[model samples]
Target: MAEITDDQINTALARGEAVRLAEPRAASVRYDRQLDRVIVDLTNGCTFAFPPRLAQGLEMATADELAQVQMLGTGSGLHWKALDVDLSVPGLLAGLLGTASQMARRAGRITSSAKAAAARANGTKGGRPRRSA
Candidate 1:
């Protein structure tokens, strides 16, 4: 697939469209403001980083505030309550500014849940000692 370009992303924001940029199963997103970039960490271990300016019209907090941001996404878009910013992933990967970092943190949480489920199937509670019969 063609990589989403900055211009295309900008157009989407201009047209008010939500873009899905990451792989469908992307698990988490983390922003690294010191580097002025957002990192998209996937469950499969692939990562993509983009500049924060790509979120054109979205309201973003100051850099210091961005450093404290916690992001949540539906894999289609991102929301940062602390920054009052919301952006679509495709717009991000395409190069628009104001949004970044979809790290593996969320994905890791899902993986942990799956592991717990498997352990339960084996009659063992995850992260806890099993009781003797």
Candidate 2:
């Protein structure tokens, strides 16, 4: 095993702060059944909401199950005890809805916002040009 050093720990903490910790932590998270979304309030006075179905593991969760949302580690994470699912506030804010590969798959899907935007832009330009015979 590699011996740990104080310098290494300090460096890691500094890096962590610059990345995720730089943003205000989530002050609260709740499932709003009426809207079918999870709402999160941040320490920086911002509120964010997303549908449970948009999340990877949360796709099949019932509204009652999603209502089990709980704040983890001083608002750094949202956890569902019954489902054994945990997600990071910063990661969610950064658009990371799942593990790396899952997010990549989402990014590549035909329904992705980027692809839709591209299609819309192409339509405005009269779409594909005619092929020369």
Candidate 3:
């Protein structure tokens, strides 16, 4: 039996292929910028950190919208109506990095316009509501 080299493993990963692992029983996930990695805090109390650039690339949100992203579930996926960005965590984890940033940028414009309208309706000039007397 021969040991697999890192280049081979990375090549398989780059092709959107799956790689078998030892089946981690306990793994918690979170982003860590200081370490520039996605830290998977495990149930065994051990932490595994992955590169942030890779995770960010795989994310379905823009740089700004990514800041506003809210994780909807513990499993996978994120939703940001304000940014109009929705993405599956699994795809990201697998390094898919689909098209969500553009959508979010476009949606951000719409959201801003809507907010402006609401502000206008509320009287942006700060005038008191006129009495119908």
Question: lDDT of all the models against the reference?
Answer: 0.59, 0.88, 0.51
Candidate 1: residue 103 lDDT (0-100): 38
lDDT of 1 by residue, 52-120 (tens): 653443234566655554545446566667656666655565655532343333345455777977778
Q: Which ten residues in a row have the lowest lDDT in candidate 2?
A: 16-25
Least accurate 10 contiguous residues by lDDT in model 3: 17-26
**Residue-wise C-alpha lDDT for candidate 3, range 73-128, written one tens digit per residue:** 44345555565655555565455445568445645656577787877877866855
Q: Backbone clash tally for model 1?
A: 21
- TM-score of every prediction relative to native: 0.42, 0.68, 0.30
Model 2 TM-score, all chains together = 0.68
Better of 1 and 2 by lDDT: 2
What's the distance in Å from true for residue 85, model 3? Answer: 0.7
Residue 58, model 3, lDDT: 37
Off by over 4 Å in 2: 1-21, 112-133
Residue 20 lDDT in candidate 2: 59
lDDT (10s digit) by residue, model 2, range 11-110 = 9989887765576689989999999999999988999899888788898999889999999987889999998889989889988888988878876774
